[model samples]
Target: MLIATTFSSIASAADETVTGIELSYDSWDYNTSTSSLEVFIDDDAVIVSLLAATSSSSTKKDVSASATWKSSNTSYVKVDKGVLTAVGKGTATISATYGGYTQNIKVTSDYVYDSVQILKNGSNAAESYDVSLGAEQVFTLSGIKSGASNENITTNATWTSSSSSVATVDDGTVTLVGVGTTTITAKYKGKSDTVKLVVTSPYKSLALSPKTLLEIDMGDDDQTIQAIATTTSGSTETVTAKATWTTSSAAVATVEDGVVTPVATGQTKITATYLGVSSTIDVVVRTPYQSIKLSPAKEYQMMLNSPGLQITAEVQELSGNDENVTTQAEWTSSNLLVATVTNGLVTPKAVGTTKITASIKGISRSIDITVFPSVTELTIDKESIDTFPEKSETLPKVSGNTFGGDTADVSKIVKWTVADEKIATIKDGKWTADAVGKTVVTAELNGLKATFELNVHLTPVKLVPSTKELSVVIGKDLALPTITVVNQDGSEEDVSSKATWKASSDNAIVVNGKVKGLEASKVTLTATYLNKTTTVKAYVEEEIEKLVAEPSSLELYPGKSKSVKVTGYYVSGKKVVLSSKMNWTVSSSTLATVNGSTVKALAVGSGKLTGSYQGKTLEIPITVSPKLKSLTLSDKSLKLSPGASYSLKLQANYTTGNPVDVTTSAAWVTNKASVATVSNGKIIALSKGSATIKATFDGKTVSMRVTVK
Candidate 1:
């Protein structure tokens, strides 16, 4: 027989737990003295257990018993009695048997249970979290449990990074590093849970919109380009861009920083590149050509024989693009035989239409020019003289003619004819005149006839006398010659009325017609008619005569009152008059006294007496001798001195009827200072000696010395 209890020995336990059982204790205790068993189970399962007791008298009694489980199953189990016991002091087991089978269970009272739980604070169970790369994520762990109160439980949780480049986790917190997928593990007490953390890069995908080419103008640099970029992963990204420019023809076109320029007169292409992608652009860089234009752009006209004309041309426009410009321009004319051009200057050589053209940069323009015949006219004025003497009295008309034409040969012939044959005549446009009169004249030039009046004037004719030939003493009238004009019918005509007369010298003469002034002299006369002038000479002569004083005879006595008379003569047919007062003088004051034309002797001396009448005067000598006291005669009374001789000189006073004779005597002597001696009323001196002589007259003797040596 066996008794069964629902307990097992708690001393033995495996290192690892089995599927559904936990060991309550590692050791068990039993008291033999009280015949009781102590049971210890895991602390979580330490409640009562079902066991069956059986008494056994012998070692093998029937011990099939049934026991009811308390904390486990409600079913009863039969155990053999040998299964209910404790192997150690702190272990217990129960076994029970109902039929032939028995089962044993172990329970421990000294077992302790410890556990920990991890949870996110204030979060749902299955929610996901997000964080940027190089950023942080936090989580909290809670809900931990231990088997008993006041039990010492130790726990440590570590965070592990699945990918260091992507993310890392520590103490249930996670941090993102880069752009990739990673896991964050939370571990505690040899338990771990992993959370997936993906770290994405901040890079964006770039794309250029509108993949077509563009066109830009040459030399235009003011332009900008825009494009769009997108990220593959629904994230924001940053993109950078740049551009490069190129040209197809470097010489013709050049580009810098997406700008293109044209260098010559040609076309070229330019392209622009942006970022890592490239685009093509069509650009035309063209140079322009220049064209010339003529002002007056149509036609010009001038006379055939006109003065030189002027023409000009100018540059109008330049063709092509940016590089087209005119460098130089020139001008020329077509049909140089009719016209010529030099440096935009045009000249016509004949009467025709000529084209003048200007050229610049392979472009040209032309102008038409025409020349025509010229006309001239002639003007004539009445015939007249331009110059005439101021002294001319007769009227002299003047006239002229004017001629103008393209040729000087138009004035080949000119003819003139006068009407009055005697006054004036014309031949071959020349005129001649003989007298003072008005004459009609006609002039013909190249068969064109014209008429004029010519005036012919007579020159004044008169007798002209020198101023020296005119006399105030002569009471005579002077006459001047008269001038006459002949008429066309051969008749004499008085021309004095038409003449102008004037004295060539002033104060010389005055005249009226054929009459002369009181003072006579030559004069000039001038006459003019029909623009013609002439001159004539005139003369006047007169004579004058008068009585003048002269010495006919006169006598004076020495040392005595004696007088002499003077007389004047007047010629026939002469005008003469005597002055009221006569002029008289004596050569010696002591010898004579003159009153009027008479002289008186004062002393015994010889002197001359002079008298004047009108513009004439005369002088005469008078003899003055010494007074005789008595007469004495001598033998040499008639003797003469050597180298000296005396001739008989007889004197008679007409009023007194006295005759006197003088002679030199031989006894009379004459000194060298005395010239001769006298005897018988004459004395003589021999050999320049002096001698005494006597002159007897009226019983008075006069003695004088005559010396001769």
Candidate 2:
């Protein structure tokens, strides 16, 4: 029975003990679970032992008494214990094992019990702020929120600012510093937000009035110019700055920043600009001038043909700011009569006084100029009353001539002095004859003197032949007579040395002062002195005489012969042989022969007769006539047979001045009709008949008979 009872007990325990539980959770909540389990217990309040069960193992779970479980109202729950405690979540099984017969229960947990809340440092807050220069600004972040939590809430958040100096935010805190705008950004949990901060200043800004400037000046290291520029607003904010520069006109001036440099002595415009505005200042450039002083400051003098004089001036340095300065020197003369300047060289043109000026830059300084005249000197060779001709006399004659001295470049008064009174006397620069001798004359002019010797000789009187009696042939020689002279003492003197002979006719006549050649029909020989000349007449007859024959004698024969006769003459009327006796000759002997003045002919030929006289000769020709003879034939009579013919030829001897005509013909009365006739001295016989053939020449006739038998 105990074994039966234990077995029965086992079966009952299985049916009553806890098995498994199911759960429905809306959220984690303990009150809903407790509430739902209470309803199944039939008591609102019960002490239940909740046992949790899993598929692997089982155990009785415990819960606090103060825990509450809640769920949806329609959900069911079973309790395995008398007391029910709410647990947070899930499903479980419960059972009671007091009696041997156990009872089982099921429990389910379906509920949500967690809550979320948000907190803030302040309700209304600012994220950014603005501050003035040198002033500080601060800002605090607010309006923080939480989704759900009963645990500690600690997380890393980030904040960033756009301009650090102007305004900045750190860990939701912001600080403002300098000017400009600032942006603050807060980042958390991959989300970000931004805020802006602006800073400004009450003070005005400063800047250079003109942003850029250009300055210009002449090319000088010391050249300076001023430039000005203005600012918009400020007391100490007005700032000035120089511009770094280069030069396009370096040959004139160079400018660097605000400084200027002059390269040469010239004018140039310098432009100085500053900022965006500019004002220009003019810089004047000056070159040092040179001062000059002329040498020989009082007067200058020179002489003609003298060496050139140099006029110079000393140049002094002047004080000034200058560049590339130079000086040129020059000179001038007021009048060339006193002096002249050629490239500063002076020469005298004449005797005078004038002013010489030295000039520079249109300003002139003057100096006096003076010139002295040259001295004059005169002298005569002789001083006395002399006899006649003097060496210093240009046209000395027997009466009395003065001797004048040569004067050149003489201007001062001259005084005359005679060394010897016997030969010549001097008045001015002239001398008068005193005696027949030589003397010296002197003249003085302003301490300068000169002397000359004078010579006086006796006058010579001349006599010459008269030209009216002179005569000469075209080509011949004649002797001229010498001119005779007499002195003042009436005594004859040899004047040939002092006399000059000339011919007053054609140049064909030549005279050598003493002798002359007769060259024309008439010529006059003249003897000349210093002022007088005498002519002499002379005659020259032709030396060669002409002779001519009144009628030349000539002879000739009837054939040809010549005879020539000539005559000649001489100045002495002497007999001369005739030209026929000198060169007369016969040309041909066949035509003619000549013997002295006679000519004879041996045959019928031409002859030439020639005669010579002086340098000329003459020729004569003669012709001779031929002897005549009557016409004749070889036979006087010609016989011809019947039916035969004959020819007759005739010849004649005739003399005529020219060729003559001769003709012949037959003159016969023949009974036979067959007989022939003759013509022009030719005969032809024909048939049987007798005829007469006759020839006539120049009206003369001759006859011959011809017969044909």
Candidate 3:
């Protein structure tokens, strides 16, 4: 019989009775009292556990084998015997019933494939892939599920690339487009994955020989260049024959393959491109010469019908080497009538100066050529000379006159001889008088001759003074008359040094070729040379009665100076300058300092200077003004071009005076002579730069900035 009995007879068995069902999962939190659970799934399936809680025991018993599990939606989640599997991406309820108790668990299913992976080559997983430029790569996509084998989803997935220019992907195939980085992605059923892709160029950099600049001479042989590229693997390869070559200007230079040929004298750019990398070099096609020079660097002299002079031309190459091009140079003459040149050979035709030039290519050098006519006449500077015995005299200089009216000194070239050796002897253009006799000398040059007469042991017959009468001021000296002697040969000789002098009056005396006046009186002086004698009269002037200074007054700034003039008036209405003979005195030494007749203002003050000559005195009033108040320039700043000149006016102002123009007198200086040069307040711009010009006058200085453009 089926009978229900509420019996507490088995108390021990009742204490172990199941009270509620508990659900747990390693990835989710389950509540025993709440009777529900929620779980997040990253994989397709997971193991779930069920437990039974006893009323009298704290420990729970595993009831997974005894529990029955059910899924709300078969497409979202499915469960069987405490095991749950995710079918799709959605949320579903999983329930377990044990011991008459049921627990509902919420399960959110992700994509059936937990992750998408990219496989390279043959099933090898890769996070990043590298492909060559203009190349292709095949990538495979796979689905990954937890606790399950990975599945190939390459065909069923949508493939995309981050940058199509760098890489393009279709299905599982990836094509490299450029040399950059891009991301490759595959998406399937809400599951997406990515892989970094780098499409690289085979070459890292391209380099060309003569990397900086290539210089070639026009009409010279072509230059061969080599192009090399560095690979991504840190290896070098030669690509000279494979590089595409181009030039900026074909007229200047042209390149084919790796050969560079100069076309004209100009500049161009040569570029070499290999794959996606390029390199360029500047090319210059110009003359190979730096400068040209000609032998016989200075002016040359030649005569008509003379042998032609061969001039040599030297060209300084760009490599700092010199080359001789005498025969290759083209020679020209400015005046063909004077001289003619052919291949650096100069031939004179007439007597004149001509400019001769030797040129090679475009460089040239010039020299002046002077053609002279044949010498026709010869002469000496002195034809006759009188001297005593045992005295030596240098022979006269010899001169040659050309037929073309040109004169030249031919002293060293002329041949000189003496006719009478006993009377005189000649050697090295010098003549020695040996005896009391006369001799004849001859000089010859270029078929022309000249004669020089020499007289020895000549006696003086009479003495004549240069002056017969003279006047001397009192307490002053006058130069004595120059004494001359008439020789026996009728030649005059100056014997002032050997003559004896005497004064007739005691008031005037001769000393050191000068006549000194001690008193105011007329005196007579005599000079004798050997047996000849001469006389002269000297008159002394009286003392002055009054003295006067020129200018009378002075106005000067400190550090400035002026000169004073003193004139004495005699009793006979005669006046003489006594500036040097006067005794000077200043009223204030602190205000001014006097040096002879010049007075320099020392400080700002007023003073008077006195000059006493004999018994007469002159006074000059001087006022030393303050230092220069200011200095102003017409332009404080200037802007000018090269080779431009501008006149600047500098005006100086003082404490008590009119403005003075110090443009021409001020001291001028330029800080930068290369940029601008200043002289006397005039500025000249030299080049493009800046400079400062300063002007100083009367202890004051002012400056102006200049810009040369």
lDDT of model number 2: 0.47
Query: What does the lDDT read for residue 587 in candidate 1?
Result: 85
lDDT of 2 by residue, 606-696 (tens): 6666655333456776665554445555467777666555545555555543433333442323333457565444445666667776555
Worst 10 residues of 1 by lDDT: 17-26
Per-residue error (Å), model 3, residue 534:
14
lDDT digits (tens) for residues 346-383 of candidate 1? 76687577887765433467788775433243223446
Output the lDDT of residue 65, model 3.
87
Candidate of highest lDDT: 3
**Which one wins by lDDT: 2 or 3?**
3
lDDT of each: 0.44, 0.47, 0.80
Q: What TM-score, computed on C-alpha atoms, does each candidate reach? A: 0.17, 0.21, 0.25
Model 3, range 414-512, lDDT digits (tens) per residue?
Answer: 677889999988875688888888889999755679998887756778888875666576887777878888887899888888788999989987898
Instruction: At residue 83, give the lDDT of candidate 2.
Output: 47
Ranking by lDDT: 3, 2, 1
